[model samples]
Target: MRCHIFTRDDWGKTLDVQETECGSPEEALQLGSAGVANQPTEVWCGPRRLGRFEPERSHGRPLPRLHALLTLAERRLHEREQHISKQETLINRLKREGRDLALALCVLDTLIETQKTHLHERDLIVAEVAKRFG
Candidate 1:
């Protein structure tokens, strides 16, 4: 978003403003600090004025608008984190299922080999009995 830091005249008319392109309101606040002197500096997004900063006041508490913007950013970050966590969990589950399927195939292969060996033994016994009877 594009933000502007403006110094307003006593009549509440804008005297001068510095335009800065920022991703978030926090960045705008940081950029606005440099333009602020003894005059009150206000941050604007597009045509809408968001918040004002006073040099006399400590920066500990943010203005209501800035606070709401920061809160929204935080909520979006948390949602993305949760989505990533769920994706990781699903990937882990898929890996475990793949391993189990591989193991089952291995067991089936072993059983087939065992059945082939038994058939070979039975053939030998039948051949011997046929020769003796003939």
Candidate 2:
């Protein structure tokens, strides 16, 4: 479960959330930074609610893991991250299309399909890690 920072717009009445960057679960899975001093004490989760949230702490007392994701947040975040990664690959391939100019460009589309296969793998790893800490 990754902890996300969200804000609300008064005029539009919309909640804004800063999503984490999508990176490989195999790569360095960095967590979010903890709350800092003098920042807004309250977070906006939705249009109807604005309040302070007690971030769950790790067992290590004062030392918490980077991003503490709620159960649903974890799953959603994972999928979004994977999508971002796949898009990155596709975009990179498209950039080369001008030079390559080949009909087999569809192979680039397969990159995302391969990513779907890895979803369950990442889920297992994340689940195990979460169970260990949570």
Candidate 3:
């Protein structure tokens, strides 16, 4: 099979194109993966795209593992957001009831700090993924 490998820059613009002949789609994928050592690459056979590979970061972790981590980070971030929302609601209710709010407010402050950490973690993972795969 004749395959074309497209090397893309950080902004996703095509920087170079190379054509090679391979025995199978797997071979084309391997070639593309190797190409990703220098830059992001896309493998195509005629009009069909066989695969895409990004420069490996995360200490040489595989692409699927990075994707899995991204998924987990996003889920955790979402859960943290919900917890923060519920905490805010509870604090508001305590205020309306004329209940002592020192402890509740303290807990809310802690939750806000934790939410900030989660946001930072999620943003880091997102930026890493975009940098590697874009």
Candidate 4:
């Protein structure tokens, strides 16, 4: 995250802001204070204040808000991506199974038709034999 340092100018009316990208809030605060020594300054990341540095007293180690937020967002996005991938795999498997089932049904239909034809032929032969013998 980028840290913005704001300080007052010579007239104490106009403000000057400088931005720096640092590893941690502590680092940013240290760099901000060192950049503008003996000046009343505040360090910020977006709208959240990391800490304040005064000429007499400087405070350190407030909180690590930006890092925590970024980590959480990244984890959630990874979980969603994994879920989408698993769902796509399941859908493809189901489609393949459905096609196999349709092919089996067509085979069963052909078998049934062949059995009916054989039964009809047997009944005709029986009728002809009974007409000659009885």
- Most TM-score-accurate candidate: 3
Q: If candidate 3 were superposed on the true structure by all CA atoms, what would the RMSD be?
A: 12.5
Question: Ranking by lDDT, best first?
Answer: 3, 1, 4, 2
Assess candidate 3 and give its TM-score to the true structure.
0.53
For all predictions, the C-alpha RMSD in Å is 31.8, 15.2, 12.5, 33.6
Model 3: runs farther than 4 Å from truth? 1-59
Model-by-model lDDT, in order? 0.62, 0.43, 0.82, 0.60
Q: Per-residue lDDT for 112-133 in model 1, tens only?
A: 5654554554454445445545
Alpha carbon lDDT at 12, candidate 1: 55
Candidate 3's residue-wise lDDT over 1-134, tens digit each?
89999998544678899999999999998888887775689999999999888886557555776677677677877888888889889989999999999998888888889878777876877777787777
Model 4, runs deviating above 4 Å: 9-14, 57-134
Best by lDDT: 3
Could you tell me which 10 consecutive residues in candidate 4 have the lowest summed lDDT? 57-66
TM-score for each model: 0.38, 0.24, 0.53, 0.36
The candidate with the higher lDDT, 1 or 4, is 1
lDDT (Cα, tens digit) per residue for candidate 2, span 1-134: 22344433211232455544334321112222233222222333333223443334434222132233234445655776676676666667767775452433455456556556456545654665667778
For model 2, what is the C-alpha lDDT against the true structure? 0.43
Clashes of each: 0, 2, 0, 0
| 10 residues in a row with least lDDT, candidate 3 | 57-66
